[model samples]
Target: MELRHLRCFLAVAEELHFARAAERLHVDQSPLSRTIKELEEELGTLLFARTTRSTRLTRAGRLFLERVPYVFTALDQARASVQDAAAGYHSQLRIALSDGISPERLSRLMALCRQDEPDVAIRFFEVPLAQQLKGLHEDLYDLGFAQSADVDDGILAVPAWSEPLRVAVPARHPLLAHKTIPLEEVLRYPLVMGDPEYCEGYCRQVDRILRSVDQVPLVTEQVKSLNLMMALVAAGYALGLAGASQIQTCRESGIVARPLDRKAVLTTWLLRPDAEAPESLERFVERVASLDAERRLTT
Candidate 1:
């Protein structure tokens, strides 16, 4: 019914313990309990089930939890928009990044945007592929960059950039004996791969490449980020599979990036809603295309 109600509900839902939630909110347990009761009375549904020893969310509570964060996200964005307007920005762009987009490409694109449209405020949200797609459909993001072109009906995906997928090998590793490592040979050793949950598109692309070979890969670790994967590889824990640009940007020592003999390429896609595009988004899309063209020319 109010901001306080949502805040108290979220705290209780997250903590699942009234006393702990009260402590987290810096309030007494009695008031927190009364607030939850009042919210339940207003909603006409039970939110949490509590026993003498434990507390947990009911089905209604779990469902309500899903929509609660959007309220806060909208509020935060509203506050940011006011701040941006006060700073003399005419408009703001909400861009999301997923699947560990190439840092070099993003840096170049950002530099171009700042140069071309200094009045536009650019905000980047690093999220999973699913969240990016959902935000696009929900009008939470103007556009997003991801490694996969796959999407549902409401979103359109366009290929923005492509780069070779390379193997990250530790220095002095046996795989380094070959200039271009074969897929079967790379699979022979343990690998540090991107987690499907955080890097869904990247994992899908890498998985498709690995499927070309009949042998099963020995994945020793599933990392959430390329840096962690490179770290594991540099420590001789396992080899890593990542885009050539991602590997090139790694500052970790003792990591040698070798191309795959099969020449698999990872493509980054620009995902947007299928509806008509705004002028700013149109310009941004064109900028992305120009940058990709320049990259292809130099490479």
Candidate 2:
């Protein structure tokens, strides 16, 4: 019935142990039990089944659990909306960023937005690909940038920018003899790649590119952060693969980037809810689009 009740129920549902759940909620076990009991009585359903040794959710509880998270999400969105309104802000744009986007391009786009519409405030969130998709659907984010274009039916993913994929080799490495390295040659060395879990979009693109190689990739390390990967590469432990923008922006010590022989590119996409966009957002997106078009033509 109340937010606290839902919180208690969720905690109990997840832990399936009264004492553990109480500890997690930072409450006494007696009151925690009372809260869950009250919730069950109010709903006229048994939410949990308990025995001396174990506790599990009832059928009703399982169904309720499926829908309870959305309630909290809605409450959070409402609170943020009220706070923004109280601050006397006319409009706000929330953008979620997943992976490493080109820093130079992001700077230029933000500058364009400030020049065109200084009144609208913009906020950025560094999130995972899954979180970005969830937030967009829940109205928590207005736009998102990710490496992949794959999205659900109601979400629109438009290609926003593309950077040529390059190999970051340690200084004085033998491969540095060639200006552009072949993918097959790069795979022959110990490679430090992005982790598939954190960098899902980027890893997916890398996987596609590696499909051409007959030899299994000699992956020495998988890292979630580019800085860590660069460090590993600089140590001569492995070769790093990344977009030209990342290598340029990082300026990592003891690491030099070389273009790949093939035209392998990492594409960043603009993800938005498939609904009518606000005029301010439309203007910002259009500016990004024009910039991307120009960059493509010149390159």
Candidate 3:
């Protein structure tokens, strides 16, 4: 079918609600439904199983959804390739960053890339995990960095580096009395935490850690960035949790970072589309692995 059909199908599949999908596509529900019906007819298979109360993807729809992003990805790459050629760039690399990357490690990686591929221009996009995943599958990004291991089979996540998770407290906060704060005590204070929708992987890991302690976190504020979370913590608004790298690099005053007694940790991972990776991507991956090894040796 046409690209519109695929777009409509994807919207419906993701929203799982006819009205919402139609609104998202800025079209009426009837036309969207007809398009989906036509797609199913052309394929000779039902894509979605819809009820008045609930709509869900059928097996075929589920399978198609898994593959459709690649079609748009190919189109996007072609456009980007032509644009890059017109701009006189010899080569281009698009990378998506989610959660937050380690500044130290990322700097080393960039240095390696510049040394190894002097002619290649690099682009970085800070996006949500879901968007990054979509872009990766669609070929919009050559590589991605995120804190989650919840990738689909089409994407492989390699742990590039990890740092001990630390608790960020306002100076003189009761929790700071202990050199290492206990999980339950950290949860006792209201937390300024990462927004789950924005920092899905990191928040999910935090959730898992909190759940293990059977403590419900009283989140005072849900922030989209680590810097803001630290700011709030320093202001004595709430306690914050972050990796040691972030806490160490934070310039916010009145924030003391202490290790957790429970040894909570977060890992930043390198994600690549599970296809035959490009030569540049392969080299970058090797550099990342090498950096990890170097870090381990020095530490």
Using lDDT as the measure, the top candidate is 1
Q: Which stretches of candidate 2 lie over 4 Å from their true place?
A: 1-83, 86-88
Best by TM-score: 1
Q: Candidate 2, after superposition: displacement of residue 194 in Å?
A: 1.5
lDDT of 3 by residue, 171-272 (tens): 988887898888889888899989988999999888888898877889879999988998898899999989988888888989898998886889999999
> How many residue pairs clash in all the candidates, one count each?
0, 0, 1
| Candidate 2 clashing pairs, residues 3+ apart or interchain | none
lDDT against true structure, model 3: 0.88
Worst 10 residues of 2 by lDDT: 72-81
Task: For each candidate in the order shown, give its overall lDDT on alpha carbons.
Answer: 0.92, 0.88, 0.88
Alpha-carbon shift of residue 133 in model 1 (angstroms): 1.6
Residues 203-231, model 1: lDDT tens digits: 99989999998999998889898889999
Instruction: Compare candidates 1 and 3 on TM-score and give the better one.
Output: 1
**Model 1 vs. true fold: TM:** 0.90
Cα-based TM-score, every candidate: 0.90, 0.77, 0.73
Query: Which regions of candidate 1 are displaced past 4 Å?
Result: 4-38, 49-57
Give the CA lDDT, 0 to 100, for residue 16 in model 3. Answer: 96
> Can you rank all candidates by TM-score, best first?
1, 2, 3
